[model samples]
Target: MQTRALRTGGFDLLVSGLLAACLLTLCGCTSDRAIAKKEKATHVVPVKTVAVETTQVQRSTLQPATVHAFYRAEIRAKASGFVKNLQADIGDYVEAGAKLAEIDVPEMLMQRQVIDKRIERLIAEEQRGQAGVRLAEARVRSAQALLAEASSQMAGAEASLAASQAEFDRTEDLVERGSLQNRMLDESRMKRDSEAARRDAMASSIESAKAEVAVAEAQVVAAQAASDAAQAETEIERSQRQEMDALLDYATLRAPFAGVVTQRNLEPGDLVRQSNEVGRGQPLFVISQVDRVRVRIAVPEAEAALVNPGDEVTLTFPSFSAAQPIVAAVTRTSGSLDPSTRTMLVEVELDNQDGKLLPGMFGQASIHLDSKVAAQTLPSRAIRFDEEGNGYVYVVGEDETIARADITTGLDDGNSIEVLSGIEPGQRVVGPHLKRFSDGQKVAVLPN
Candidate 1:
């Protein structure tokens, strides 16, 4: 009976083992099916995407800048003189050629007076010479008249002698033929001789008159030459006076261009000498044009290659307003870098027509070294961080799956960030709603 009970218990144990094995197998199959169904339920999600492409970026470099006047000139005394009065004071705005100061040059005034007096004397001498020329002309006319009268007298005397000679010839022929009286012949002969002597005397008078006329004409020529010399002297004197006047005009200092007076060196009664070289002597005034100013900057040697003319630049005046920046363009640049400073000089022109910006104002300039550069970039928001804090972005894979791609970030220009590595241009990246995507998640890339 105990042996029969042991067999029955053993059979029951066998059946329990079979049931436990079958239950364990069924549970394992059910768990695997549930996991497979859950994974299969993850459908292709509709997500926005953008192509990874190159974009233009602007890069800037900051440097110190100095503000200077567009044009600066030292108003100096051109003539040795004293400052008689200051027409313009420091900070006064003056136009080009406007008088800045009046100088009192006693010697200059005296020299002008002397020139004036000399001119008057020369003019008077010219007038006297003209009168002398007229007097000489009158003498020539008188001599000509006297010579004509002498010629007339000689002609009359010759005619009378010819008549008397004819009478004498007729009377002598009558006397020889004894038909006329001898006394008549003698009277005709005497009359003919008297007429001949008068003709000779009249001829001599004509020669004398001609000589006198020639002398008078020579005197007239001399007088005319003297007159011309006097006139030329007058012209010379006038030219000299004009020169002196020009020098005298220089005594009044004038603005070389429209600008503000930055400095004043002379007061009333200050003796100022002529200043030719700058920084050598005190100037009466210093004028600088503030309507337009030059913003000068020194670019480092490393960045000099990026600077060029016509490139836009920004300037900020720390002494004036730091927030408000003045926008201008690079007007010029020194082609060669400075050996000592190892920097290249750049200049920007700024208009200050409102007279707000002053010369010598301190400022800073930002040069857009690379104004616009095309490079591989992405929107800042598109970048993501992985669990390990690595920079990455979600990309659309070839199989229409979300791929976590690692990328190296470069310059961030507020609008976009540069991708230096691990991503190629023209590749599609998940756009907005990137959080909806997970690793290996199937997705439908929407049109951008």
Candidate 2:
């Protein structure tokens, strides 16, 4: 019993010594943990930072519009006529100046034929006048020859009269002196009287020849005048024929432009009058050019300032096919807004190289009202919402401390938000660790 009491007392003393050593070790570990936490608290908070930058952003709006052809016309008659042939029908594609229909104007045709016949008659008359002129010239030559013969005869008669008178005087003197007989004297006197009569006749013939020449020359003048009149008449007839031919050419109705014939109301053997007349007349054909089309979109008044000429656009033809939209640009616009609808008319031109677009269709145009507008931007992660749902961002100042900058946002493209006011560009902003940052807290910025 004495030996057992001694061993038990020794085991109890070892247990007490082990408990004291453990307590000492636990105290030292607690003291070290306190010092480590104090050092960490003194260290600055590390944060990712970004700079506010100016960049471009686009805002868009869509408007309803109608598709129209670049050119459209209602072909109508310019002159009264009967439709002789119907060459084109609705939905037929026609080229420029292609014949669409024909008219039969028998009156105009007959008048043209009459003018041609009149012209031929005038030509024949002119030829006859020319022949008459030749005949007149021949008569003038004959008269000249006759005048020459009459002058020779007059000269001969005068010489004979002179000789006869001389002989009569000698014979009378001889008879008085008894040197010549009375019969001889009487014979000489008779010869002289006969010569004198012949001379007077020749003189009359010369005058007649001269009068004939004058008449012939006057006839030549008259004939030439007639020929000139005929030539003038021919010119007049030619002009009349030209006018008649122009009227007859109105017989055929042709296309004014390359287009599709949309309407055809006249047929063969139908009496069609001029469309511009007092009575209500139907158009022979309605044609529309569709190779390219125009879409007039109405832009709202609110976005008028953002739209301008040469802006890119997207056109969707919902009525035709919505799968593929046509891309084009704003070609023009109505500078003034509509008072009733308060919308401005904007026009877009689209190319239809594949012939998919047509006139008289409904479409939608997406217009880039504004794009690439310069603004202060921040990363989307930097924006924070307060209790009132107002947006803000953390901006680090020159002292390495953050401050809450309340900004009015313009556009949010999911990656960045536009800062309309309260923040300038090139300023330092807290990027992702925005929420953890408190106002006026010091932060260590990491290189971007």
Top lDDT model: 1
TM-score, one value per model = 0.63, 0.53
Candidate 1 — which residues are off by over 4 angstroms? 1-53, 57-65, 168-178, 276-279, 296-316, 319-324, 328-349, 362-373, 377-423, 426-448
List, residue by residue over 207-325, the lDDT tens digit for candidate 1: 99999999999989999999999989988988988998999999989999999999998888888888778778666789999999888899999889989998888788877673577
For residue 247, give model 2's deviation from the true position in Å.
2.4
Model 1: which residue pairs collide?
Answer: none
Q: In candidate 2, residue 281 scores what lDDT?
A: 62
Pairs clashing in candidate 2?
none
**Model 2 spans > 4 angstroms off:** 1-54, 58-64, 136-221, 277-281, 296-311, 330-349, 366-371, 376-448
- Tens digits of per-residue lDDT, candidate 2, 67-183, equal 888888888777688787888999999999999999888878888888999999999999999999999999999998999999999999999999998988889999999998898
